[model samples]
Target: MVQHCAGLPLAIVVLGGILATKNNSLNEWRKISDNVKSYLKKSKNQRPDDVLASSIASSKQKERDGGEIAEDVAESYLMELVESSNIRSLLFFNEFFPEEALEKSLPLEVLNYVKEHEDEVCNPLVCIFMISRAGTSCLKARGIWRYMFNNFKLLRALNYEITRGDHSVGFKLPSDIGNLIHLRFLSLKDLKFSWIKLPSSLGNLRCLQTLDLRVGNYEIHVLNVIWRMEQLRHLYLPFMCKSRTKLMLGTLRKLLTLVNFNTKNYYLKDLINMTNLRELGINFPFNFENFNEKELGENPFIIRSKYLHSLSIITQWLILSIDPRHLAHLLSSCTSICKLSINYARISKLPEYHYFSSHLAYIRLLGCEFKEDPIRTLEKLPNLRILEFESSFEGKEMFCSAQGFPKLESLILGAYYNLEEWKMDEGAMPSL
Candidate 1:
């Protein structure tokens, strides 16, 4: 199923959602597959862009002969991908093209979408994407989104990236954005701005499933409206944002991938509700403020999901603020993690073997500088396959017990200049 969409996440969602409503008959599915192949394989020699370029040319010719003007066409094919009911998923692809070439035609096509479709008896739900091409002229992109917000109320996916050069110094999300009740995906990632704040009206996007708020070159303040998106699956906050940008997410019970989360803005208890979460990332300065190490052992903060396979805690060379026991109990809570990565944690010692996840297959530690030998402790992990250490030890002697690392396949040690003695028992690391 993943391979069929070329492993593109948006394509997977769009195709999967479309397929869910189809009949289970194999013959019927095979016929639909043939049409998909024909649509994608327009010609043996034509690349995807070539097919797109040809599509614009064909749409323009059709428009001249009295067909729909914005038949998912741009004045130049590279300018914009117009929305078509059948090919709604292709417009949001991250493609880079010059904005100067299609300056005149971009607005005309966008403004005409509502005029042509407003009177249609029963139009299918559609999606529209407005990718901000670098070097876009300021005058060429004005009033485009205003038109979209005023119209296109049935839009499902809207990926809009605006450049600092394209808009005025102050930019605000239009209140009408809340009217997009049917929207499933909304990505404003890579918007170059100074300071932008999400409006309270954004909570009206009750049906949104994917929301990306990553911004470039400036800070964005997200309001607490995300808690209203009860249907959200994948949520990405800004890579960097205002310090006190209080946002709540406890209601996202069905969330899958959560990125750029720091302990600063959100509460740890909120994680208890995301039972379906699979991937989670903690951004810089993962603060563990007001922690009690002794109490942590008695009552660990267990993340409820057993499906979480990857865990990452990345910081900017800052030492971990919590004690080693805090990390230990935290690791013990995640019993299903297969891979673990921590950088500059300053824990001084690795967690006890019993505290580590038994399912862990790979581990990487950087700059932790464990005061004690980690080999003896970590070697007991029954399913361990790979172990990596970089500047994580400051010892002159190291030892591996007999019959240790039974299933290990790869071992890497780096930047241990103080090592003067090394001992491995005869039967240790036999599988290395």
Candidate 2:
């Protein structure tokens, strides 16, 4: 009996279940052993689980007046079990696994597999979470998402993380996706140099709160219909050249976080009414030579909301410059900003503002060459907790005075090739 079950735990458990339900007659035991052996002989190349499944199916058929079950009918039943088990596994697994790990592996496989067996899989249309990775997964097949969207009307979130290595096989979003009014969160990341075609129908997702599209090197086309998504709370998109169309975004009063957006054709005034905004990320386009810094600083478009706490600016080109005076205006505009990140901009001197916001706690500077010592200007921030410098500042010496950065906890300085000297006074960065 042990040899017939091959000593596998799952097989033993299933056989035990079968034995528990049947009469303990020698004839019944012999019949079950023979059936298992016959199925094992037929499924030699398949997994042991497959053989067990076949044996169970044959036993059930024999019990039902010895009628044969159609292959399609049998497959449908097995698939139903698999679908239910997989969904439960995902829901349980998500509690322990990190979001990035879940995003890259299991969830993506489940979506594609369910989509492939759409007709046979039970409840295939209900997707609570879906993820598609690059190259390795079958979801990369062109228009697969579009076809799948027709089935997934109740989808809540969809994430796509494609590698930039294979630009030729980029995915597309069908206009039909807009029909999924229940969708609340969506993300499209890492489509380098690939063009993403957005449909005007995307604006129909009024229930959407999070839209993340921070592809490393790609251009996303937007339609004016985007401004109509009144329920948006977080918006993340790529920065491209100026669009001819205008977008009035201030009406999205519920918005809390905005990231990596282009402000080329749209005036800063369009965002002044977004009173609930807390975090802002801007990736300035390359054609900012014509943008007037003085005019922008004085413009009523300045963000004065107390809810605004984080600000980030990204620049790709070398010619794009941010003046010290303009920097001061930005700092003054958002007095409550706690976190600030400036990247790839040319700022020769630190802003003249002697005292930064009292609430400011974190500062990250990258690729912004400085002619003056930034450490001197930054050390006085009373509530500063985290300071990071990457390939920024070329000063010869840095001194940390006593009582500097009283609440600071973390200090990270990297890629400063020319920094030769550092001095720290007693009690400097006491909490660091």
Candidate 3:
């Protein structure tokens, strides 16, 4: 039944999933094949939705026979679908939240909704929680969040970010948040508040798969319960933590995108466990468990993740602590990375061309204060196409040799205040 609609993505996914489950077990594969054949013989007009439903029902029957572990395996199938680049980005318009009711149900649809309906029962089906930027939203959001936690048990997605437009009181995350057991996605980013008190009950969200906790404030007390979210795939941590934030993440084999990872919150050696990671963002002033700041600045450990494709680095402005050697050693491990962003780093020149990834295509340098010609090594990046510099380099003149940037297409330079001349030879950037 699943394979009848052979060319369609729906059918392909259904068939591909069954193959993964069977995994070299011909007996299991034959059993599933027989089950699919039985379903197809009953349906006359083969439709995608009908075939899809039959496959799901068949999967459920197997889960019932195989016990509770099968249920976990079913969830893993869902994660596989989410991880697939082909299906992940496809937009399912209002699949959860109704388009017509969204205007009336969204908590912050109107700027005055929170103020007007402090005790209002928001539409229970509301999935996306985007509160207005109004500062007053923070005060009233407490009751709203609590209500949702207690009521919306099966809610799948939630996003909350209430800026402190004029309010001074901090937002307190309700401990009852653990009650949201079915929540798969949650984002609390850009809450422009003074402080955030994270509840320990947050560990109860075992089903959460995607979590973003990057608030604007620097003071965020993140409990070490994140290791419990074994299903987490994309995790965006805060830019900085309030106190010591230690987490054991060796079990998160499914994690793919990790942002704002620093040694203070995580063990640097634990990175090797996330072999499936594709995108990573880290903070600077490399302070690992055993390495002192001075030691790390002198000789940094070379990261080794073969699958990482994107890397974002943000160096703290604390006494200009980062060195070019530190970044050189770090980039050597991420040879597969395609996009690189270096922000507020202390390096005065670009790293050697050999340290850059072989797949590097785009680079954005901000506040690096490069005095030498930043293009010397960068222009040699064979795959580089887009290069952007924002107040990143300072010099009286810059040079680009002939045939240096063969694949370059876009070159952007901003805030080059002291630049006196830009010298590029013929064929320096043939693609531009």
Candidate 4:
């Protein structure tokens, strides 16, 4: 039977041992029955039995005789094995069965066998865990989640991918997900949870360092909860709700190396508060009018950022009418900024009365209109190396004077509607 049931090696070993003990006598058969009964009567240590049952239960239905395993018999044997002792010991043998073994379809009876032994499938003591939907009709089958959530608590790294036939189906997360305090990494990608909201308790995963939640159209309201996790170093949230809501930016200020932030409507004050931020990317409309320019003007936007080296701002429109002096003051505050990008801005001309910084090395102007000579204004940068211009400009004459850029290295002139000629001295002609 061991060699014949090629798919279930562990079950074959255990059941074959019992069969060998029975020899070929009715007395041995009676002993085997009694032993199985006693094994079931023992404590809830049937992890091995549950694993064996799931392995055997998932075996291809087609038998050696070209017939499928009878659903009733498969289910009955699985139930009997699950009720046996030494179930918890099965968690140690993840290599016993090949991954392909669970790919085959099983009978409904085999599914019922798994459903009955669900508790044994996931043992908190076992480092190796398995959850199979091969025979189960629904994910909500009794004891299914209990086994999963309980076992998840002990996992150091978890990769759970469950497939429901229907696209509209949404899986509900167990409320006790926070119990996985030991989890350091978690990945949930290409999943459908449109109807379910992430539990706030997930914030309790204090030890988690990496979390990737890249599901589509799933609305998550746990930003506040996520903000409280001080130990989190990397978070990948590619998709989120567009509805405006106040985010807890102040909570993330403590992260010294926070490199990426792909969110919208985030309070600028909260972002400005993160003194240690490096690379930052934000996509959403911001109402500059709401910024407390008067009170916060004492400490301008750039002044608070001592470590900020790169900044990118994208929105529908940029308010150019902002007090140029205030804008210049804010720009001068960032003593360390090396790269800056502004998209859809209204400011066409650079302010003449402003004090410029020497650290500004690169500037990218996208979809913006200028009222004054942009090139002449950009000429103030003694250290400017690269400049990119995109979209047509209302001004016709381009500023290419020697005094404009003494140290300029690369100049990309693009999409200027009525550009006639670049005015520059022969000595100031850039090598490019």
Q: How far in Å is the alpha carbon of 244 misplaced in model 2?
A: 3.2
The lowest-lDDT stretch of 10 consecutive residues in candidate 3 is 124-133
lDDT of 3 at 161: 55
- lDDT by residue for model 3 over 301-405, one digit each (tens)? 445557678999885545254667657867877879999998887677877999898789899988888878888899889989998878987787888999798
TM-score (C-alpha, index-matched) for candidate 4? 0.54
Q: Model 2 TM-score?
A: 0.63
Off by over 4 Å in 2: 1-143, 163-168, 191-195, 239-242, 286-301, 316-319, 353-355, 423-427
The whole-model lDDT of each prediction reads 0.68, 0.67, 0.71, 0.55
Compose the digit string of candidate 1's lDDT tens values, residues 162-275: 665555344456667887889999987766543377767889999999999886656677777889999898898888767465577888987878887777877676776776
lDDT of 2 by residue, 92-180 (tens): 33323354555455456555775786664343423223233233133334344655577678999977665444444444566787888
Between prediction 2 and prediction 4, the one with superior lDDT is 2
Task: Give TM-scores for every candidate, taking all chains together and pairing residue i with residue i.
Answer: 0.65, 0.63, 0.68, 0.54
Model 4 root mean square deviation, Cα atoms:
23.1
Clashing pairs in 1: none
Task: Please tell me which model should have the higher lDDT, number 3 or number 4.
Answer: 3
What TM-score would candidate 1 get against the native? 0.65
Off by over 4 Å in 3: 1-144, 163-168, 192-195, 287-304, 315-319
**Over 4 Å off in model 4, which ranges?**
1-150, 154-177, 183-193, 209-220, 234-245, 256-265, 288-293, 296-303, 316-330, 345-357, 429-431
